[model samples]
Target: MSTSPRGRLVVAAVLFPLILASCTIDPSTGPVAISSATSSGVSLPGATFPSGAPSPTTASSPTVDTSRTTGSSAPSSPTLPSTTAVPAPRIRTSPADGADGISPTAPVTVRAQAGTFLRVALTNPEGRPVTGAFSAGRTVWTSTEPLGYRRKYTLTAGAVRPGAPRTESTSSFTTLSPLQTIYPSFFPNPTMKTVGVGQPMVIIFDKAPVDRVAAEKALSVKTVPAVKGSWFWWDDRTVHYRPSTHWKPGTEVTVSANLYGVHLGGGSYGEADRSMSVTIGPSRIATIDDATKQMQVFVDGRKVKTFPVSMGMDKEVTVAGQKISFVTPSGTYVAQEKYEVKQMSSASYGLPVNSSLGYDSRIPLAMRFSDGGIFVHAAPWSVADQGVRNVSHGCINLGPAAGRWFYDNFGHGDVMTVKGTSTRLDPSDGFGDWNISWDKWLAGSALA
Candidate 1:
């Protein structure tokens, strides 16, 4: 307590060193300590220290920073390689594989899926290629021609897509076999060029069709100056078409039989199609009256000439168990043929040449009109009986002059009407198409 000022200054310098050694500064904590105790056993305000513990010094180990510690980071997931899948090409065919009994007219086709076609082929049993064409994009193929009946066909096709493998397909099929086939033939031969007004359109078949309705539906008739007409079946193999009346002069007629590929029933099919055309000529008609024993010829509704004629004598003879009539049957007939000289014989009608009513001789200027051996010809031996008495077989007896004139004037399909006779003319005797009524003719058609 009794020290001088100089002595106090020396003591102060010595204490300053000890004070600096006792304190330490931590960067993480605040700058001041609170309620710390000094070496004099006194408590200092706002300074903190643990009881019976020494204060921190600058030499203490530096605080380790645990927030940023590093040894090895977490391993990342391995990435999978990127990839894309492609579709393969596919080929399809019609009349599928191993097909049988296919129609010849059936359609044949090939198609590609997810691809374009590379090649396509169809071949017959004979190894010949069938004709076909591919679509614009080369994805489809179709057949162009009809196939043969009872034939086997093969198809081979290939297709491919971009960055994909090529694909191929094959198929085989067989066509149906018909039991029989029929062909049609047209008459008044196509070469005739022109025909009479009363001429009918006739069709004859090599083999009869069981399905008559099918055959009738396949036929068609067209006329320029249209006329109403109907078809009549004369028998199983014959059919005829005629107008309600005689065809008009100058009329053009065309007939068609569209029968190919048509089914005719009972396993039968049509072999081919046919057609014909003909022009109608001027009208020429001949009328005979048995009461007057005269024949009048008319052209276009005007009488041209007349001739006295003697018809068959009214008699009958029995030979070979057949009844032969001498009377000429009465009905309409057409001029079928002509000859300068034709041999007449009774043997053609089942009468023996040795019989009492039998005679064989060469006649002049003969014109046949009936299938029963009836004709209009010259009989100089019976000239006295002309237009006076009937004395001869079933023929119209005319004088030599009249016979030559008639033969020179008449031709095929010229109409001839005969009246006043006991027997009736059969519809089957010749071109008897006109004998049937219109209603009856229409009834004969299968479609009716």
Candidate 2:
């Protein structure tokens, strides 16, 4: 409807109250005025935007338009920086990881790099911790004693940088089994403070080893001032190490078996390393001449005494109630045993006692050389043939005074060499390595 300007003013004033009832006030701008010409139920161009919005030409306008987008809008918060810087820890080990046939005695060591160590632990399969200690500087750690055989061990190490997370590493390994192990029992017993100059170093095995060469290579001998020697195998179970000559009196000898990781074949391995030091006593040797029927005793290479002695009988003798022979086998021998009064019996030697060929007698001042009942003992009955002829059964028959002197002086390891006997002595007849030639003795060595 059209109205004159003057009449419209009067109508406009009356319609103002009614028009104001349908319009809303804008807080940013004062009020929104509505006119009948513009009231078409449609929004004005900039009316949809909130007040104080930037215009199209304003410098504060957003770079991208988001009005046509479907989702609600606010920019996402920027990603923040991490709180701490962490360093990765690294580990190195001895006997290296996954190594096989490791020695039980070898040390297990662990070292960590790039950070201070926090903790380290070594455990067996049962989770029982192995005892260990860190180095003075705290960079490396090692187990205190030998590890077990056929065992699985686990090692865990931890380290950390300042204000950073702890870093850790782990390794696992298995040790050699008992089936791969060999142990050597040494000679001279190591308990004897002093041994004879002629005492050979003996080593006996609990079980026979298949790879004798490998086993021999693991053994070594050292003297204080170094002496030449050779090792000889008596059998699969026994071995001897002897110097070219007797040990120099007062010299120290050290024998070592470094077989920790050595393979002894037949699924046997050396279990652990072993070593021993021994001292040699004075040199004493007795040389018996069967042809002359005399015995010469030497102390440190100086002939000290000569005694007339009648050795083993020319033939087996049977007298009284026993059958006995005085024939002593010819060889180098050690004093196997000694007794003041040893009862002699023919039955012990598989010979029957008969009135004419055998006799049982209790002998005095007896020093033995073999397990077969051969000895240097007093034989008063053969005193007439001491230095003239061999008339008694095999044995070094000495006069009463000479027998007492020899018996008192000679002990377990004294040396005696017998010459001119038809009966050859086996090397094992006694503890007599001197019976074997040096070349032949060396040939017995696996490492030769």
Candidate 3:
């Protein structure tokens, strides 16, 4: 409506101010601030102040747009921190190369992270067992036998994950320097003999041995009756054997042993088994009296012969212990060799008559027995001292032919008893094993 010049002029003035305010506003910049606490008025650069400084005043209620929804997911998102990192595996053994030795003493062990074990084996260049021994434990693997002395050997081992098949790893390394020359002493000496039952086979080694199982296996005792027997190592040097019970008087027994490469009880090895033959003789019993210095010889309990034998003299007193050892059988004996008078020099006998009743002295015998030195011997030089006295050391002094007759009849286990001596008898003496009381002899034998 056209109100007139004044009314239109008034409306133009008010509208003109509003138009100037809009012109000064940055249309592209939208608003100067959208905050609720503060506001400023905008005016054209050429416009003049309408009133004073256009003082700001707080509005009790203000109009604002609140119609749009602006909640949406952001394009770039936040990430979390990690706690673990992987590690590299390791190698522990060497030839550094995957090579092996001509002979390896042990398998190469490789330690790596993936806590699983691998296969390690010894092989010849041809991939054979290589004579190797291996050991296995809860968490470790090792070799059992020492590697072959001079052969080429290879080792193959591997590691795999917990549930997977074991992966193999191979390492090639030669064992240290070659083995040294070893001189073994456990074997038996070259000179030894195998014996029969009558012989009471005995052995004396140079050293004590600890490998008893081995030593026993090396020894073999066989007989038709299949007698039970054992080997007793009396001392470092001596070992004796006997039947579980008394040997059958006429039964032949064979004893053999091979200790040439045997390891005895200790680190020592036996030299070898020696062989000897014992002729079983008819059983006989002999009795003697210390007070009388007399010997009664019986065959199967019948008195067949008598002999005057001397007991040990004062200092050379006869051994008082029982002879439950190597028993020389009783039989007629011949003077295999003898001397009417010969020089003797051992400290045991008073006269210079060193006779081989069943023995051999470095010096030739003044008298002799059969194979072993238990003889009815002579001492022509002691002729005056013969029958009337029991003065000769433990031997039966007789006329030469009498001794030969004794020798011709006597063999191993031929009983011969000597009594009436002041000396002592040790288990080591050979006075006819029966010389000792039967009870005591039985006590000495395990089966008795």
Candidate 4:
């Protein structure tokens, strides 16, 4: 329409307000037209312009996400690593499979890792099962008894976890076969188990042990009420144990030589274990004085009887290139053995019967006190010299009645202390362990 300038200004002024209310400009998308009903619509830069737009009749199509436009793709979820199943626990056995030369004393054991034991067995060569016990929770098993020497043994064990199959394992081992085996013999044989307080625990090996310490280590002494004692190696084959003082009367003692499977040096091994138990009877001690030529007997520290005695004559004689002293060595001694009628012969000590000082006779009511053929016996021939003079070879001569009384009253382990002699008793002579001082006795112990 061609209108004058004044008319155009008037029209522009009237439409300016309406246009401003209908159209809005966006900085990024240029301009947007407003629908009268919905009041929202998007307009592209080059689209046809409209002063007003109608609202859609139905609910507007679900709002399209304008964040992503048409030529772009959606991102995929991150890939996850695959998972694996866990295995069940395994069973273990000791000694390892195919082991040989195992000690018979060593314990056989079975264990399970993070599982409970299902079954365990150890079988000997004879197809017999060895005794064993299971630990709490059934997780471990151990053999209860020692195995046999030079024998093969088999072990089998099984364990399982919840909802899993049982896992089993097997092992085989062989015990050592010793080249030489030595057996130990204990003193105070089983027949005469009761002994005096001075009696010591003695063990004599059939074969001399090269490693005395090893042999000593295997020996043990247990006394009721607990007595302090130590073992002394008397010789290669003999070891003796004594208390610091005389064993208390009525004490019970148990000795163990647990030497099985012990390597005792050289090619020797212990044959088997041995044990002995003995009870100490009433304390009976006899003291003899060479100067007084008298013997006093005591029971439990109380003097009970006194008798005349004739000790060795304190004479030395040369026989077979050896000087044989008739004087009995003085020291502490223990009654080792008793005999109703013991045969005495100087020839036993290298003196022949033809020699002037040699004599062979059967003596009655004899008790041996030393390994060197010394004894206290009934001597009818020397009865007159019993109290007044010292006569007879290395023996204490007692009247028949006195000897009988001693034989009837005294037994093994009874103490016999002798005084006034030039020579001292050797510790290895009979049960002469009391001759050693307490300090020296402890020094003899292997463990000490």
Best by TM-score: 4
Better of 3 and 4 by lDDT: 4
Ranking of candidates on lDDT, top first: 4, 1, 2, 3
Please identify which of the two predictions, 1 or 2, would achieve the higher TM-score against the true structure: 2
Which lDDT values do the candidates have, in the order given? 0.71, 0.67, 0.39, 0.73
TM-score for candidate 2, please give it.
Answer: 0.72
Off by over 4 Å in 2: 1-84, 92-102, 124-137, 169-173, 259-261, 271-274, 316-326, 354-356
- Which residue segments of model 4 deviate by more than 4 Å? 1-86
lDDT of 4 at 193: 72
How high is each candidate's TM-score? Answer: 0.70, 0.72, 0.42, 0.78
Per-residue C-alpha lDDT of model 2 across residues 152-209, encoded as one tens digit per residue: 6666555554433345455566666656457788877767666777788888878888
Model 3: residues >4 Å from true position, as ranges? 1-198, 244-246, 258-262, 265-279, 284-286, 315-343, 346-376, 381-387, 430-448
Compare candidates 1 and 3 on lDDT and give the better one.
1
Of 2 and 4, which scores higher on lDDT?
4
For model 1, residues 1-448, the per-residue Cα lDDT tens digits are: 5999999999999999777766544323322111110001101122211122111100111111111111111222233322342444555566655566555555566666677766666777765666666777877666655566667777766566664444656567666667887889988777877777778899898999999998998899999999889889989998999988988889999998877656788987777668899998878887888898888988878999888888889999887688889998888887778889999899998988888988888989998988888898988888888877778798988999888888887777778888997888887787877787888989988888
Per-residue lDDT value at 352 in model 4: 91
Q: Supply the global lDDT for candidate 2.
A: 0.67
The alpha-carbon lDDT assigned to residue 111 of candidate 4 equals 62
> Residue-wise lDDT of candidate 4 within 179-217, one digit each (tens)?
788889999776667999999888999999888888888
Writing each residue's lDDT as its tens digit, candidate 3 over 327-353 gives 223333322244534444433332223
Over 4 Å off, model 1: 1-98, 105-146, 154-170
